[model samples]
Target chain A: MDETIRTILAEHGHLPVEVAKIGDEDDLYQAGMTSHASVNVMLALEDEFDVEFPEVMLRKSTFESVAAIRVALGELTGS
Target chain B: MSDAGLFRDELVAAGLLVLTGTDGIYGRSSVYEDIVAAVDGLAVGAALAEGAVSYRFPPVMPRQVFEQTGYLSSFPDLMGSVSTFTGNNADHRKLMDVAQAGGDWTALLQAAGANLCPAACHPLYPTLAGTLPEGGRRFDVAGWCYRHEPSVDPARMQAFRMHELVYVGDAAGATEHRDRWLQLGVDVLASLGLEVQTVVANDPFFGRVGRILADNQRAETLKFEIVTPISSAEHPTAIGSSNCHLDHFGEPFGIETADGGVAHSCCFGFGLDRITLALLRTHGMDPGDWPAAARDRLWA
Candidate 1:
């Protein structure tokens, strides 16, 4: 569980440090991610996890933290 | 449509200063300023109703950031980069030697790590991501947009103005909002007497998938634009675009609502320069004798 969480964070953590926890819900924009950083993280997550992000999930509220993104991906892929 | 020749004559009669030059820049005259002021007044008036605050963005951006955004991959045809050298006289002479020999001189000098911003959205994303609210939100923005299209037409320039109506809501809501604005936008242009047509468009993302994506976009009707013929009477020019970004931005910014849901986002952008071109074509360049209705809508 820890490794999987770290992997996810490694792929999506572009915001400033300690912004949130692996499984805790936090705001991505509020936590300090810039728009350019957010785009990089999104493209990275898609590449690393081999998942295509749906058009509906592309907003500031979705990439709040690892937990939120994981929840979004799980729902999208039904994993 | 107004007669093109008569419109030119009106432009002359109005004493609108026109400077014909071989250098690419055009339409920076007193009349152009008048047009910009009029458009800005209308935008500010509309914004007051929505409680949107004003913002200004710079015209340049970080090079690495742009590369990460796929700009280099997509718009190599239109993107320009800043370049510089750091060495002393010896290094400068070495660079000149390569240039004199006609070798790979460009590779010798380091890229300046800066890029000319092609659109207003480039800077906006950073600002939005920096100061986004707890839930989803919206913004009304106006910025000078730039593109290096290889054309001498006065209508098509390296720099122009863009007015954007942006909304950050849930996915369904964002899509609906964009559609609503598309219809309203048509009425706004028609009220000024410009003949326009709405068509699907793509921002030309990079690579093979980009081509497929653009094609599928048209097939699926994911994007649409308001266009009219100005630069060319045959192929219409895009005056405004209503874009639905689905989750592309949501996944990046982490913008969510109280229910722990990722908000969907949409934006509608009007190319003020292109719109001016359309208006010039439709209403005639001389504002002095413009249709009484159009004048009242503008000056008043």
Candidate 2:
């Protein structure tokens, strides 16, 4: 799940720097992922996980870092 | 309640506004129209002084343009679009029958190719999708903007006129443009006897992830508003705003700078009717009795 989340961020994040350069808990927004890019990221995540993100999970922190995304996906996927 | 002199009700009593039986929609009286025009002129003059080229647009924008701007995904709740009755006679009969029966008649209309413009700048982006000149360009644009927010508060109108000065250029130029107008918006309104305050602000982006988006915008100091007491002092209405869109439009529209980098953009914008309301709230409904300074500044 973690690897898959990183792959999605790399493909959809639109970050100025490489995903490899970002740490597990580093700020994606600070790394140049724009609000629009985050929307794209969320959509991509939904497609990959086959789970719709409930409104309660739709927040910045839900996708703030790789670890955060992994945790949210874990809850949804029970992986 | 009438004796308490509510501002919205007072405008109706003075024949400055006609009730439309809708909370956010109102028919403008000649007096209200005159005031709206005067306030729009004041904002226009500020842009015109900077040699900004002017453009006028209709209230609706192309559906393609709306989609490209990402307003749909970010603000679907407030977004509105045109729908048309493109059905046959039989379909029309059904629609009418449904309507007469107090059923959902709107299900018959097909989606039109245009969306009601939420901002005046939405139409301007497509025209700006190219490499800029040496120092970039300034455009003064105006249009009727639509949002689906219906409210009993007179200041928060569903349809309003926005007069904006937009800049497309480098990142530094965009931020500088926003900063310059942030001060200008307050100064000009204050000169007219409005109690103004410039505060950091954000657009009402939709949903929860939008919270992060809004926070990032505020953290970067990307938006500001010149607010004044329209209905309440504690919850002042935003009469004018400055936004720095750093390549937000450029990336999608391919607007490039002289240096071949993505062009940055900014807008110094205001709502015409809201400003008129602020003026009325500050002074009175009658423009003739307004202070000479305010009157001269507006009519001059």
- Give the number of the best model, judged by DockQ: 2
Candidate 2 lDDT over A1-79, as tens digits, reads: 7788888999999998989889999989889888778878888999998998887776666788898888898899987
lDDT per residue for candidate 1 within B7-121, as digits (tens), equals 4345445554253453234545677677767866776676567766666666777876676546665678778787788778998899999999988878767788888877766
Error of 2 at B186 (Å): 1.1
Task: Kindly report the docking quality category of candidate 1.
Answer: incorrect
Each candidate structure's TM-score, on Cα atoms with residue i matched to residue i, is 0.68, 0.90
Worst 10 residues of 1 chain B by lDDT: B1-10
> What stretches of model 2 exceed 4 Å from their correct place?
A1-5, A24-27, A40-79, B1-5
Give the DockQ (2 decimals) of all models.
0.04, 0.37
Off by over 4 Å in 1: A1-79, B1-24, B93-109, B130-135, B261-263
In candidate 2, residue B288 scores what lDDT?
93
lDDT of 2 by residue, B1-300 (tens): 422137678888988877798777889988888888888888788999999999999999999999999898778888889998998999999999999999988888898999999999889999888789988999999989989998767888888889899999999999889999888888888888888888999888887667657866777789999998888777889999999988888889999999999999999998888999888888888999999999998887
